[model samples]
Target: MTDEGELIAGRYRLLSRIGRGGMGVVWHARDERLDREVAVKELLLDTGDSAQAAEQAMRRATREGRVAARLRHPHAIMVHDVVEHAGKPCLIMEFLPSKSLATVLAERGPLPAGEVARIGEQVASALAAAHAEGIVHRDVKPGNVLLADDGTAKIADFGISRAVGEATVTGAGLIAGTPAYLSPEVAAGGEASPASDVFSLGATLYAAVEGAPPFGDDENPIALLRRVASGELVAPRRAGPLTDVLLRLLAGEAGERPTMVRAREALTAVSEGRPVELPPPRRPTLLSPAPRVRRRTVVVGIGTAALLIAGVLIGVLISSPGEPSAEGDQPPVIGSTSERPDSGCVARYAVTNSWPGGYQGEVIVRNDGEERLTGWVVRWKLPAGHTVDEVWNGSLSRAGSTVTVRSADWNSVVRVGDSVSFGFLGAVEAGEGAVPELVCLPD
Candidate 1:
């Protein structure tokens, strides 16, 4: 019921309501003392919670607000203060005159690939900064992205959504983001992390370039959630050069998704039309288990197909054989593998991700023997000018074009029906064979 001209805390006067979101109402206000314009967000807490829970939520919201104020970035809205007014937490932020990305997309339809990539790069840079400070913008979507009059894109509502999430309960549950842009893990009722923010950003950019969400936007929140939870996404036809980067951001497993820093790098590369070169994985374990698939029982018990659809949607489709992905769509596994047999063992090699002069690949070694294997070696010959620069989860040696990978002591034993994997980063001359036949031998 706060109207124009109402003074909150005796220092800031509300001029007009500028925007509204899932967490609260935002107002265009004037700082009476500072003599400047500011945006004030009044967060709405769920009254259904116990008095104690609500108070705890208030405290956490205040703390998060303070932390948000400490973050400074060009593409992020700055938090000026967190004040208690009328028993609600209100965040004072920098006011920039502009329309939301959502409004622009609604009016203009899908934008050009280059335009979207540039915008994504700015927003991703801001999110990267926030993440470095340990802040996860749980709600990232086109609506939260402001297209300023000066053509700068700044992300709003950093810590506020998380604060409201402490106590706000929607009819659909306590989800924090718009159903269409949520990561599969968040839609599946897990905690939001930096990776979730990356997925959400990917969905946002996907909508910007494709004119629709990866998962079609269903009217029923339940149905959308179900689609999101299923993590099935329609392929992007118009993403053009942005296809690979978007796919990386939308990876179903959080760990599989790149960090915000890397996301920024990828977006930057796309904006400039160059292949992105990623650093070697800090610690590459056995290819992370295929993305999490919510059990059918869990899905059915949650609600009707209509209700479950309210969840989030995401997927890069990293599935194993016979496992149907979200929405009953069966997308192929990412890379093709070549297998070669040698001396009681087998090695399968697949190039996971590649760039202009370099590529990443993995080799899975299986004993295929009745007895367990104490150790194994995988060998492959790189096409003339190609070379492996780094290897993980195994030891590496090379003689001329022949590359030999021996298992690390910790992962040396391969039990019956079990397999061990090693990954590498290699540089390849243009036009050389991408996937090489791998040979395995018992050590």
Candidate 2:
């Protein structure tokens, strides 16, 4: 076996091992012939597997390179070459200075809604390209999502992929994919399709924002699989404006989930702090229809369950007595205040992250008036018990619920039509109205 500090194909020299998965080992290697760096994946075949199984595994490894090479997108991993080494297949891929989504979530808890939306958009776009090529990525999990240092998110791991109409590689009645991210139909031995990929994508992004899989992280794989198949998702309390889109994506039925293209569009809107709307399914999957379900007294999907569980979840999370929210759960609040007289600047307040009794809100100040200002300020009023926990991109000086923010040194100047945004983490007692009419003023 080739270990560290070895040469593969007499062309690529392995420097160090970077990652390992069930099917292969990835190494940080250099293409000596080309005088650049690249990642090399060595297929790991099971000796105990049947001859046919071993052959299929090798073919799958080669196919990964072929499939990825056909895709040319900023958010998709690039496949450089596929070569033979030690009588086995080695797939050469672009070396990205990045960490997996799983690593990010593990180091830091759930991400802010805006960041999650951006990640979801990039991954969804990559998936859309793969689906257009008739490729089905059976495995879509946080561990397979690479978040580049340059703020790009891309999908990885096509070892388990199969083109549409292709026979199963894992054999009949055998399931492939991580249990926590599998679609309901895939958990039931159904074929992997575009819809299934979308479902898996949604599950990954859900985990990104919720801090856990919707079904809860069951230690046992069997238990996790059962939860996914049964559509037992815990309602999200901290999703903020992403709740609607997240719920629609986590729908139990594959046909019910938005298409990858549609999901990408919706995620882009969310990331840009625009009005987020999920488009309905484009067309039902002809190859694999959604699993049929008989109606029951209680709805089995996330859509209805979210509405039913909102009140109870809110009450449990925000226990302090305060003014009741207008909607049962916290409905999305997106509004911009009128221009202030002094600086003629307008500020828009949008909540990016949230928790029970608390949230992370961003305010974007726009210069809508005549002359350019060197600096600007804004002020707002929160509920009686509400307080600012932290401020970013600006300086915060507050007197109880009345808070004022001054422009940061870096973003001091604002020309006409130019905007700069700042955010804060704040908490209010349950049932309290923390909405603020942020009015910009002279610095």
Candidate 3:
């Protein structure tokens, strides 16, 4: 454990221990350079490791640092730096002054559907971004998610994430992720993928609504892994349609599970109080008989260019002419606008961090526009192929292809600079894609 006044990397002044995990201790610190609060994770080295293990550990740390640095998303915890502390690896990350989902649920009970959906969307978005970059977050569980003071959900701890095509540095005997959220493939030592992350998201969502993990008990890790491998976990009906989505995600066969995009759509429907229909199963082509190829017949013909010109002239006369243009000309109007006083108000939104599982983020709606806004609505377009899974902080309604979030009575009023924040969960399409569009409205 680090002393209260101890400083790491000569830049971060440790304030106090915020958390402790199997790998190390997490301290809340002040970044003297950025003048912002940050979290520093310090790992303590075990004395018995041989030279080979030490080299492997260093390699793993280097790989993790690279992966974490490459991942950039609103839901992902930003890594500021990685350095050696006490001869072991330590990572500096964005400091979140809020509690984890597990602690919040323990104290506040089950969260509402809207909150769950919003959190799920943000985490899924983050995962999509990481997966697009070929990084698989090996660990996705409730404890990894932090609900920030600004009501944003940020995923933390990339210590075990593996970049695609990279050599596996963690030993074979050790399990990398929490047993309760592990996919069957992961339990069997198979490579993790975006699909695996979706499975973990399902488990995390199940726990969020049910107030406990699907397969958790007082039993040991081995027993939990056995249950997960056997596919004997129960769905959390209390989570509503979220349970159905989880069932699909937790399917023993990865091919049978819905893609993150599809899952997000289902959850979005649930959040909007609409019925969700599962997509048709993709048929296996190999199981069907192959079609016979057919030979094409060739035709020999001759045409006269002079005759074609006459036919074209006759066709043009038979077609209707274009519509007439309008007669009047209108003048453009310009007006001076003043910013609302409530523009400075901060809107708060929350994302529940469940690493490797889901992506979530929150948007704060401030009355920056020149208006006393009430009963406001916000609309935004996700990336073309991306989809929203859940939403919270108000009534979320979707029209056509756009998502519209409206403030409820308790959250509706925003006077001159007053702000209100809302959150959403989405499954970002994994690949090299542009960031989704964001827009807001008042009144």
Which residue runs does candidate 1 get wrong by more than 4 Å? 48-53, 166-177, 278-443
**TM-score of every candidate:** 0.62, 0.59, 0.58
Best by TM-score, which number? 1
Clashes of each: 14, 1, 25
Off by over 4 Å in 3: 44-52, 159-177, 218-220, 280-443
Residue-by-residue lDDT tens digits, candidate 1, 4-84:
999988888999998876678899999999999999989887656467755766787788888888889999999999887
TM value for model 2 = 0.59
lDDT of 2 at 231: 62
Model 3 error, position 147 (Å)? 1.4
Tens digits of per-residue lDDT for model 2, 152-221: 9988765333311111212322222345676765553334678878888878888888787766665444
Taking the tens digit of each residue's C-alpha lDDT, what string does model 3 give over 234-343? 64556665656666766654556777777777777767778879753242111121222221111111121111000011111100113122221111111111122343
The deviation in Å at residue 62 for candidate 1 is 0.5
Q: Which candidate number maximizes lDDT?
A: 1
- The TM-score-based order of candidates, best leading, equals 1, 2, 3
